[model samples]
Structures are given as C-alpha cells and as structure tokens.
Target: MTYIAEQERYDKMTYNRSGKSGLRLPAISLGLWHNFGGINVLENQRAMARRAFDLGITHFDLANNYGPPPGSAEENFGTLLKQDLAPYRDELIISTKAGYYMWPGPYGEWGSKKNLVASLNQSLTRMGLDYVDIFYHHRPDPNTPLEETMSALDLIVRQGKALYVGLSNYSAEQTREASRILKSLGTPCLIHQPSYSMLNRWIEDGLQDVLDEEGIGSIAFSPLAGGMLTDRYLNGIAPDSRAAGPSVFMKPEQVTEERLAKVRKLDELAKSRGQKMSQLALAWVLRGGRVTSALIGASKVSQIEDAVGALAALEFTGEELALIEGILQG
Candidate 1:
C-alpha cells in the first residue's frame, strides 16, 4: 500500500532555525540510532517512520555505524525510503554521519578526506538517496588536523553530496576551531550534535556557549538519557530495556537505587504539572530555545507518539524549574 503523508503534518511541530543557516528542523526529530537495525522487523520500522512523519517530524537522523553490523540501519532506511517516503523526499530532513569505526582498516573511519567522502558515497548508495540534507563528522579525530576535517566537509557541500555540514561529539574548542576553518573555506558549519540530558549536563560546561556565540544550532542526542528520563524505569529496569540489553553504552548498574529515587521524585513533579516524566525531560531540553530538536529513539509507534506529546506541554514556570533543579541536586 502507498503511504500518504497527513495533510496537516506541518501544523503541529515547532520548527526552529538551524543556527544562522536557512534550514529549520522540528522541535522533536526521530533518530534511527537504534531499533531500525538488521535485528528489528522491517515492517515495524516502516510503521514508526510513517507515524513520525504523520505527526510532523520532518527530520530523521542516522549514521554510518547505526546498525549492529554497521550500515544495516541505512539499508533498512533505504527500503523505507523506496517504499514509503520517496514522494515526500523534499518535505523531510534526512541526515547521516561518519567518523566512527565503520570498517576494519584505518581509512574506514576517522576524519580523512578519503574516509569521509568514500563513507558518504556508500551511505548514499545504501540509503538510495542522491544527497542528504545534513552530513556530519560523527566524532572528533584526534589524529587528524582540524583543517583537514573541516576542508573535507566544505568539499562535500561543494560536491553537492550534502547540503550542510555538522559536527558531533565535538568539544567547545574543537567546534570553535572547526567553524573558523569552515567559514574561511566559504562554507559555514551549520550545527553541532551532542549528548545532552538532565542527567548529562556536559554541554553546559562550555559547548553550549560556543554554539550560541558561533550561531550554530544544536540537536541533543539521548535527550531522554537513553530512556532513563521516562517512566519506563520508575519501577525497575525491564528485561527488554536498553539498560538490560547487550549495550556497551547503557549498563544495568547505572540504574541504581539513587538514580531511581531521583527519577521517582521527578516523576512526581511531572504528575503534579499534568505531564509525564518523559515529556518534562524533553521539554526541559528545548526550554530555552537553545536546542533545535530533541532527537529521540523508539522501537514502537507508541513511543514516537509519546515523545511527540511532549510538545503540548513545553512551557516551564520558575517554580517548576526550581523544583526540577532541587530534584536533580538531591
């Protein structure tokens, strides 16, 4: 069956500027970092994608190493694109990144011109797209010179493989340097992707300041702290949860009693405000309008609906903000 996008899709989401660029992304974007892998059912992934677009989530974030076997997520997404999203391509913002360990050899990863270029070509092939809206360097390459990496990004935009370029997992200093080089090359760096959540406030240390000063947009990954901010773990970690899975990033031990206590307190605060814990957490990230989007991952369509519901209650009062801070401090 052909998938027709909802006519009222644009009415719901709040689209914000991607830095000083002309691009605008939704307040909440869908991330294919998990569950769109080879292990997951293709039909289920299709349903999630449709529901997201139907709900006005125009951006779908992906990376070269997103799947369990690397590249499988793009393969799966390619199928979805061919089947459902081809007609609505121009209405969506599709982005992907490279720079992680994708293949065995050294050229398979990092910030080399050869790696970034070649990896994008493979990504395009797998995703069945002529070009991606945004292409990113997945992480900082300590061995590669900033000039080299930034130059490659400029080249990508000039070559028409990507419309705009972004940096992920980059520090304040690194983002500043990279933006400088890209600006010198006549291609401004548009955005930065970072791990940001109530539990992980590393962005506040310096990164956020750099973004604001440089006029670069920020999209927060793990905005729900890898599902920890939600009510899913208010009781305990379900066996099927990310913390219980074979994830190297999420661990069972991290779901300690202390964390659960904090989550419960926050959950209580959310209930008092007529919102869910997840909704409170998502809105908190976008509270100040600093972040352009909260990139969320989901396995089921219900989770997508749940995250999108956050937009309805994005406002936060001084009292609620103080209570949230108190809970975090406790």
Candidate 2:
C-alpha cells in the first residue's frame, strides 16, 4: 500500500509551546534511541519513521551516539530524511545532542568546546543536514568549564549549525549554573531533557522548579520508565521486552517483586479508568503543563499509535492522583 497520513492527524494530538519560545512541539515526540540502528532492518526503521510522522509526531530526537555501533542511527535517519521527509523539513523539529562517547581518543566525548563542536559537525554530516532545530549538551562534564561549553553552544547557534540550545541529564543545580553561563553568552537555553516518569521522580526533586523559574521548556525522556510503567512486566517479564533484555537503562534486577506489585496495582487503576497502563502513564506525564513533550521510543508503529491515542483522554481526577501516589508509596 502507498503511504498516506491520517487526514485528522493534526486535530487528534495536542501541541504545546516549548517554554516561552515561538516553537511548539507535539505532546509526544519520537526518539531514535532504539530500533533505528545499523543492525536493524532498514525497511522497519523507514516504516517506523513514516508512521510516526503520519500520526502527527513531528519531533524526532537523535544524538551523536545512538546506534549499537555508534553514529549509525543518525546515518540511517538521514537516509530516511532525504528519501521521504525532505520536502517536509519545515514541519519537523529535529534535534541531536553530543557529550557521550562517539569516536576514538579524548576529542570524541564530553562537554569541552573541541568535543562539542567536532561532535556536532560529525552528527550533521551523519544526519546529512546543514542545521538541526535543536542541539544539546547530552550531559554535564565536571572537568569542563561551564563557560567553555556554553561558548561552543553559542558559536554553534551563531554559525547557523543549530537554531536552539538544550541541556540533558543535568541536575537542578547544574541546570541553573548552565543557564546562567549560556545567558551570559547571550544564548538563552531553550530546553532541558531529563529522564522523568511516574516511578522516577528525580526531576521533581528540584529540576522542574529550576526550569520553571528560568523559563526553560522540559522534554521528558523515558517518561514510561523504559517501559516498566506499561503492562509489559505487570505479570512477569516478557522475553522481548526491555526489562527482559540487557538494556543499559532498564535492568531486569530493577523490576523487583515489590516494584511488580506496585505496577500491578497501577495496572488495575488504569483498567478502572478505562485506559491501558501505558496510556495512563503517558497521560499522567503530559497532564502537567511543565512538560513540553514526552520523548518516547517505540519499536513498532502500533506502539506509537497506542501511545498517541492516550492524548484524547489525558485528564486525571484528584482522587485518581491520590490513589496513584498511594500505590507508588506502598
């Protein structure tokens, strides 16, 4: 069948402004952190991207080192971009980051000026793009001076390599410091990406307050807690799920008996609300206005559709919140 988008795609999902910026991103943004690797089938990755865009998931997130082999996911995504989505570039909010290990030697990783600049250039080359909608420092480097890292981000924006700057995996305190340094250089930090989910409340410890105070948007990564918030492990670990695999982010040991019990209670609550566990999880995160978008990763088109469908019924009652907290606390 020839590819055709749903006619009512845009009308289905809600869009929110990123902080105070003129740009607005979809409530759910697709991340190329998994399933778009070099070892994966090309047709599957292409189909996934096509399906995501067709479903109004306009933002696609990538990084310098996403593939199992590193750097291959961006190359693969670039091929898809040129072949299918090139004509609709203006409609897409593409983002890439640096700060992780990418290449050999000391120049390939971290938050130094040399590493950030070189990494982005390599990322652009792999992505086959002149400029990304947003470029991010993937993580904070204690050894690197904040001024030097912010300077690199400033130069990238001024050089037209990226339209906006972002920071990821930064603490509330570090975010404030980075924001100050970036602002001093006249480059306002636009967004902050952090791993946030119902089970993980690290961001709430103070990160959200910092972002709100600084007027920076937040795009939450792993909002589903690497699929644990879903029904995949409520009964037990599914062989094909992340919890059953050797994932870097979510480990099998982390899903203890106690955690599974909490998940089962949450799953029951979801059924009571007439929604799936995954749907409830995504909705819970998006219900808060602080989140600009939920950065999600899916291996199949159906998964994407299922996640997007939750946007329609995102409201939660005070009692529901209280019950959820009770379950989480227990």
Candidate 3:
C-alpha cells in the first residue's frame, strides 16, 4: 500500500528561520546517522523516512561516513529517496557532509579542496541528487588550510552542487574564522551543527554568542544525549538500546551509578511537569534562542512521534530552569 502523509503534520510543529537564510526548518529534524546504515533492513529505513516526512520533518541530515561499513547510509537514503520520496524532493531540506574519514589515501578525509570536492561528488552520486540542500564541512581539519576548505565550499555552491554550506564540530574561534573566509568568497556559512544537550553544554562556552554575532544558525545534534537523557538507563540498560551496541559513541561505563541517579531525579522532574524525560531534555535544548533545530536519530517511528510531541509544549519556566541547572550541576 502507498503511504499518505498525515494531514495535521504541519499544524503540529513550528518552523524557525535557519540563521538569516530564507530557509525555515522544522524545530525537530531527522538525522540518518544510525540505524539507516547498510546492515539494517532497507524496508525499515524506507518506512522511517516516509514516517518522518509524513509528520512534517522536512530536514534530513546525513554524512559521508555514517555507515559502519562507510558510505552505505547515503546509498541507502538515495535508494529510499528514489523509491518513496521522489515526489516530495522540493519540500525537503536534504543535507550531507564531508570531512570525516570517507575513503582511502591522502585526500580521503579532512578539509582539503580536493577532499571536499571529491567527497561531495561521491555523496551526490550516492544520493542520486543534482545538488544537496546543504553541504557541510563535517569537521575542522587542522592539517588543511582553512582557506582551501572554504574555497571548495564556495565552488560547490557556485557550480550548483550545493544550495547552502555549513560547518560542524567547529569551535567558536574556528567558526568566526571560517565565517570570514566564506563571506569573502561570497558563500556565507548557513548553519553550524554541534553536539549539544543538557549533558553536553560545551557550546554554551562561547559558540552561541559567536553564531548570534555572525548571524549564523545552529542545529544541535544528540539533543537527548545519545538516549542517556531519556529514561532508558534509569532501571537498567535495555538489551535493544544503543548502549548495548558495539558502537564507541555510547558506552556502558558512562552510565555509572551517579549518572543513573541524576537521570532518575531529572525523570521525576519531567513526570511532575507531565512530560517524558526525553521530551523535557529536548524542550530544554530548544529553550535557548540560538538553537534553530534539534537533530534527532531514532530507531523506531514511536520515538520520532514522542520527540515531535514535545514541540507543542516546549516552554520552561525560570523555576524549572533553576531546578534543571541544580540537577545538572549536582
């Protein structure tokens, strides 16, 4: 049976302007960083993508090295796009990144002109698109010249390969420098994707101020702190959870007794507010004005629905903020 989108999708979520650009992204965007990989069943990936679009998640994030086998996530997403989402292409904000370890040899990774150009071309080919909505430098490469990286981004936009450009995991200082270089080249940086959650407040150090001053937007990844902010760890590690997986991104050691206690306390606070722990965590990230969107990865369609449901009631009072700060600081 052909899937049809929910009619109330647009009415449920709010959109925010991405920096000063004309793009308005849904407050909650879907990311294909995990579970949409090569080893996973393609049918599940297709269903997830369709479900996301049906729920008004217009922005989809991807990277060149998302799959465990490398490059398979994009390949899988491309197949899904062709098979299920081809008609809604214009309505979607599809983004992909380069700069991580994608291929072999000297130019496989990092922020070099050769690397960026080659990686994006391969990404475009894999995704079966003429151009991605946003192309990001996945990370800052210390070995490569910043100007060279910016030049490649400029060329990508000029040649109609990417509609906009972004940077990820860059510090405030690096973002300032890259902004200047991109501005000089006539291709302004559109957004910065950073790993930000209540547990990870590193961006609050200075990145937010830099983005505000530069008029750039920010999309926070891991808004639920890799499911740590959720109630999954309160009792014990679920066998099906990411913590139980072989991935290095989340480990069992990190969920110490102290961490579980904190999560439990936060969970109590969330229940008092009539929301789930994941919803509270997501709402907390969106409270600050600087965050344009929360990039989330889900293994199930129910998770996506739960995450988006928080958007309707996303306000936090000052007292609530103080209690959260106390819990986090404790």
Candidate 4:
C-alpha cells in the first residue's frame, strides 16, 4: 500500500529554528530510544512513524546502541524508510548518534575519532542513509581528548556524512569547549540533546545558558522523565509499564511517594488546562521556546498523537508558572 502523507500535516505543527541555524525542527521530535526495536512489532512501529509524519514531525532520532542487542533500532528504521518513508526522505531530519558501548572493545565506545567514525559508519549502514541531517556525539568521553571528539564530528561533516553536528549529554563547560572547537573547525554545533524534564532539571542549572551563549539549539530527551510525568503511574505502577519492566531507564523504586505527590498535583494542573499529564510536561519543556524541540519516545500511535496535541496550548500564565514552581519546589 502506498503511504500518502496528510496534505495538512504542516498546517498545525510549529517549526522552530535550531538556535541561529537555518534548519527548523518540529516542536516535538520522535526518539527511537524505546520500542521500534527488533524485538517490537514492526507494524506498530510503522504505524507510529506514519502517524508522526502525518502530524508534521519531521525529525526521527536514533543512536548506535538504542536496541537491546544494539544497532537494531536503526535497522528497523531502515526497513521503515524503505517501505513507507522513502519518498519523503528529503523532507525529513533524520539523526543518529554514537558514543555508547556498541561493540566489545575500547574503540567500540567513547568519543575517540576511531569510535565515532566507525560507529557512524555502522549507523549509516544500519539506517541506509548516506548522510544524516545531524550527527551527535552521544556523550562526552572522559578518557578521550575533547578536540579529538569534536574533530571527529567536524570530519564527519566534512565528509558529507552529516549535514550538521551536535553534542549530547555534554555539560555546560563541555558544551562551550566543544562548540569553540567545532567553530574553529568551521562547523558550528547546531544543537544539543540533554536529559531534561520537570523531574530532571539539571540542564537548567547551567546548560541552557551555555547553549544560548553558543547560539546552539537544544532538544530535550526524556521530557516525560521515563513516564514519571504521565498518567501511567498515577494509580501506582502498572504491570505493563516501563517502571515495572526490567529496563534500567526507569525503576519501580524511583516512583517514591514524594514523587507521586508532585505528579498528582501536576496532573491536577494539567486537567485544569484540559490537557493530559504527558501533554503538560511537553508543553512545559517547550515553554518560552527556550528548548528547540522535545524528543519523545512513544510505544503507540496514540502517544504520538497526544504529544503533537501539546502544541495546542503551549502558553502558560504567570500564575500557572508560579504554581508549577511551588509544586516542584515542594
């Protein structure tokens, strides 16, 4: 069956510039961190991909080690691209990263040039892409020289393997340094991906300022905090939920009574705004347009729809903002 995208796909969704870059990304981008793996149903993955694009989500994020067996998510997305999204390839902002434990060896992980180049080669092969829109260093390598890593990114761009380069999980100081290096290399850092949510606000401490100073846009991963900000755990963890599962991303014990109290209060606020808990979290992350995009992972097509719906009401009143601060401070 031929997949015809919704003609009105770009009508409702908002696209924001990535910092000072000419490239614009949907406010909500899809992350293939969970699900969309080899272990999951390909049909469901296909549905999610189609629904997301139909909703004007042009960005699809993946990493070298996203799957359980590693590299499977890219392989699955490759299948999806060929079958459903190949025609729209030029219209998409496909991205993938390297910097995690992929293969067994010292060179398999980290930000070394050898690792980054090899990892992206593998990622490109797995995704069947000649050049990703953006290629990111998954995390700062403690052992590797920062220049070495940034140089690898510059080399990737020079080689036309990636249109732009970015940094992920890099601290404020690290980001500043890398941005300087990349700038010297004539390849400015386009964006930064970091773990950010109401529950996890480390980026606010300093990273946001650095991004602003560097003219680099940001995409927040885990905007829902591993489903902690959603209705999934409102009545306690469900057996089918990620917290109940063996995934290290989210643990059942992390759902403390204290956290639930805050979540409940936030949920009340979301209801008053006629939004779901997930939608509210996403809106909050994208508030004031400080963050370029909120990267969300969905297990179902409905989740993609719900995320896109967050754009309907992204504004927050001063009082609402104060109330949220009070709730979070408690």
Candidate 5:
C-alpha cells in the first residue's frame, strides 16, 4: 500500500525560522545517527521516518559516517526514499554532512575542497538525490585552510549539489570566520549543528552568541545527552541500550551515580509538569530562541511521539528554571 501523510501533520508542531533564513524548520527534527543504519531493520527505519513526517518533523539529518560500516545509513535512507517517501520529496528538508572518517586515504576525510565536494557527490549518490537541502562540513580540520573549506561549500551551492551550507563541531571563532568567508563568496552560512544538552552545555559558553551574531541557525544534536537525560538509565543501563552497545558512543562508565541522581531529580520535575524526562530535556534546549531546532534520534515511532510532546511544555517559569539550574549545579 502507498503511504499517505497525515492531514493534521502541521497541526501541533512549531516551526522556527532557521536563523534569519527564509526556511522554517520544525521545532523537532529527526536525526538518522542511530537505528537507521544498514544492519538495522529497514522496515523499522521506514516506520520512524514515516512517523516523524506525519508528526510534522520535515527535516532529517545524517552524516556520511553514521553507520557501523559507514555510508550504510545513507543507503538505508535512499531505500526509504525509493520505497515510501518519493512523493513527499518537496515537503521534506533533508540534510547530510561529511568531514568525519568516511573512506580510505586522504581524500576521504576533513575540510579540504577535494574531500567536501567528493563527499557530497558520493552522499548524493548514496541517498539517490540530486541535491541535499543542507550539506555540512562535519567538523573543522586543523590542518586545512579555512578558505579552502568554506570555498568548497560555496562551490557546492553554485553547482547545485547542496542548497545551503552548514558547519558542525566548529568553535565560535571558527564559525565566525567560516560565516564571513561564505558571506564574501555570496553564499551565507545557513546553520550550525552542535552537540548540546542539559548535561552538555559547552555551546552555551560562546558558540550560541557567535551563531546569533552571524545570523546562523543552530540545530542541537544529542539534546538528551546520549539518553542520560532520559529515564532509560534512572534505575540502571539496559543491556540493549546504546550505553551497553559494543561500539557505542556512550560508554557504560559515563553513566555514573552522580549523573543518575541528577537525572532522577529532573525526572521528578518532568512528572510534575506532565512530561517525560526526555520531553523536558528537548523542551529546555529550545526554551531559549537561540536554537532553530532540536535534532532527535529514535529507535521507535514512540520516541518520536515523546519528542514531539516536548513542544507542549516548552515554557519554564523563572522558579522552575532556577530549580533546574540548582539540580544541574547541585
């Protein structure tokens, strides 16, 4: 049976302007960092993507090196596009990034023009798309010249390989320089993707200010802090959870007792507000207008439902905010 999107897809979702750009993204965007990999079940990946789009999450994010074997995630997304989402292509805002270790040898990684251009071309082929809506340099390359990196992004835009350019894992100073370079080339930087959460507040130090100053939108990844902010670890780590996965990004040791205590307290606060801890965490990231969207990952359609629920309780009273700060600091 052909899939049809829900008629009420846009009913409850909030769309925020991507910085000063004309694009308005859903407050919650889905990230294909996990569970949509090649080894994973394709039917499940299609379900998550369908559920997300039905809930009005129009933006989907990916990176070239996302799968266990790498590039498989794009292959998975490509399969979904061919089988289910081909008709709703115009309604979606798809994005992908490079600069992480994707292939063998020098041209496979980093911010060099050779790397960025070739990476995007390969990514387009993997996703079976002519142009990605947003193409990001996954991270800054200390050895590469900033001019070369930014210019490659501009060239991709001019060549119609990517509609907009973004930077991920770039520091404030680096972002300012990249934005300036793109502006000079007549291609304004569109967005910045950063790892941010209640447990990870590094972006609050200065990156947020740089983005706001430069009119670059931000979409926060790991808003739940690798599931640490969720109830998933309140009691103990599930053997099947990312914290326990063989090649997990979140090491089991990282889930210390101290962090669990904080999560428990936050969970209580969330209960008082009629939300799950994950929903509260997502809401808090967008509490301030600085972030254009919260990029969430889901292994199941239910996770998407919980994430979308974050929109309902985005407001925090001054006292609640202070209490949260106290728990985080305490």
Candidate 6:
C-alpha cells in the first residue's frame, strides 16, 4: 500500500523556531529512543510514524545507540522512510545523535572528531539519508578537548552531512563554551536536548538561563520522567512494566512509595483539568514557552495520539501552576 500523508498535516501542530535558527520543529516530536528497534515489530513502528505525521508531528529523533543491539533503530526507520515517509522527506526534521557506547572499539564512542564523524557517517548510511536536519554530540566528553568536539560538529555542517548541530546532556558552562566555538566556526548551536520533567527539574538550576541568553532552543527528553509523571505507577509498579523488566534506566526500587504519593496527587490534579497525568506532564514541560519541544517515545500508535492530544489544552492558569508547584513540592 502506498502511504499518502494527510493533506492537513500541518494544521493541528504548533511549530517553534529552534533558537535563532530558521528551522521550526513540531511542539511534540517523536523520539526513536526505544521500541523501534530490531526486537520490536516494524508494523507497529510504521503505524506510530504514520499516525504521528497525520497528527502534524514533523520531527523524528534518533540516536546511533538507540537500539538494544545498537544501530537497529536507524535501520528500522530507514525502512519506514523507504516504505512511507520518503515522499514527504522535506516536511520532516530528522535528527540523530552520537556519544554513548556504540561499538567495542576506542573509536566507537565519545566526543572525539574521529568518533563523532564515524558515528554520523554510519548513522547516515543506516538511515539512508544524504543529510540529517540536526546532528547532536550525544554527551560531553571529559577527556576530549571541547574545541575538537565543537570543531567536529562544525565540520559535519560544512561537509553537508548535517544541516545544523546541537548538544545533548551538556551543562550550562559546557553549552556556553561549545556555542562560542561553533559560532566562531560559523555554525551556531541550533538546539539543546536535555532531560527535563516535573519530576526532574535539574535544567531549571542554570541551563535554561544559558540557553535563553545564547539564543539556543531546547527540546526536553524524558519529559514524562520515564513514565513516572504518568499514572502507570500510581498504584504500584506493574509486573509487565519497564521497572519490572531488566531495563537499566528505571528500576522497581526507584518507584518508592514517596514517589507514588506524589504521582497520585498529580493524577488528581490532572483529572481536575480534564487531562491525563501524562498529558498534564507534557503540557507542563512545554509551559512558559521556554522549551522549544518535548520529545516523546511511544510504544504504540495510541501513545502517539495521546501525546498529540496534549497540545489541545496547553495553557495553565496561575492557580493551576501554583497547585502544581505545591504538589511537586509536597
């Protein structure tokens, strides 16, 4: 079957400029950080991608080490591009990252010019694309010189392998320095990707201020705090949940009763607003218009639909905001 995009694809979504960059990304972008791997069903991935695009999601985020085996997410997404999204290529913002352990060699990871260049080249080959809209250095490397990493990103842009370069999981000081280097090289940092949510508000400490000053946009990953902000664990961790599985990120002990109490209060507040806990969390992340986008990972098409539905009611009253703060603090 041929895939035809919805004619009204761009109508329902909000597009925000990436800092000073001319590119505008959907408020809610699909991230292939999980569940789009070789172990997952490709048909479900296709359904989610199709549904996302139909609902006006124009960005698909990926990383070289996203899959369980590493590189399989890009492979699966490449199949999706060939089968469905290839024709609408210009309408999408495809971004990928490198930095984590991808392969077993010294050149396989980190922020070195060799590793960043090689990782992105492999990513392009895996995704079957001439250039990604954004290429991110996945994390700051303490051992590698900052100039070398930023120069590698500048080089990636000059080489035409990536249209723009971004930073992920970098602190405010690191971002300021890298942005300085990239600007000197004539490729200003376009965006920053960070872990932010109502449960995890570390970015508020100082990172957001730096981004604002530097004119760099930001997209929040784990906006749901690995599903904690959602109602999934309000009662308790389900046996089939990621916490119960062998997942390395979130574990059962992390879901303390203290956390569940807060989640329950948040759930009540969400119901008062006629929204799901997840929807409220998404709205909160995109609140104040400070963050450019919220990156969401979906296991099924319905998750994507639910995430899109969050945009329907993005505004929050002062009282609502205060109550949320109280709930988070309590």
Q: Give the CA lDDT, 0 to 100, for residue 92 in model 3.
A: 90
Error of 2 at 146 (Å): 0.4
Model 2 vs. true fold: TM: 0.97
lDDT of each residue in 1-330, candidate 3, tens digit only? 666667787777779998888888899999999889998999888888888888889999999998857889999999988888888899899999999888789999999999999999999999999999999999999988899999999999999999999999999999999999999999999999999998999999999999998889999999998889998888978897778988677899887888888889999999998889999988899996679999999888889989988886688889989999999999
- Give the residue spans of candidate 2 off by over 4 A: 1-7
Regions more than 4 Å wrong, model 5: none
Model 2 residue pairs with clashes:
none
Every model's Cα RMSD, please? 0.9, 1.3, 1.1, 0.7, 0.9, 0.8
Candidate 6 regions with alpha-carbon error over 4 angstroms: none
- Residue 184, model 6: lDDT of 95
| lDDT tens digits by residue: candidate 4, 16-113 | 99999999999999999989888999999999999999999999999999875688999999999999999999999999999988998889999899
Better TM-score candidate (3, 5): 5
Instruction: Compute the lDDT for candidate 6.
Output: 0.94
Estimate, for each residue in 62-149, the C-alpha lDDT of model 2 and write its tens digit: 9999986799899999999888888789989999999998888988899999999999999899989999999999999989998899
- Which pairs of residues collide in candidate 6? none
How does model 1 score by TM-score? 0.98
Specify the poorest-scoring 10-residue window by lDDT in model 5.
240-249
- The lowest-lDDT stretch of 10 consecutive residues in candidate 6 is 226-235
lDDT of 5: 0.93
Point out where model 4 deviates above 4 Å: none
Error of 2 at 311 (Å): 0.3
Highest lDDT model number: 4
Model 3 bad stretches (over 4 Å): none
Candidate 2 local Cα displacement, residue 258, angstroms: 0.7
Query: For each candidate, what TM-score against the reference?
Result: 0.98, 0.97, 0.98, 0.99, 0.98, 0.99
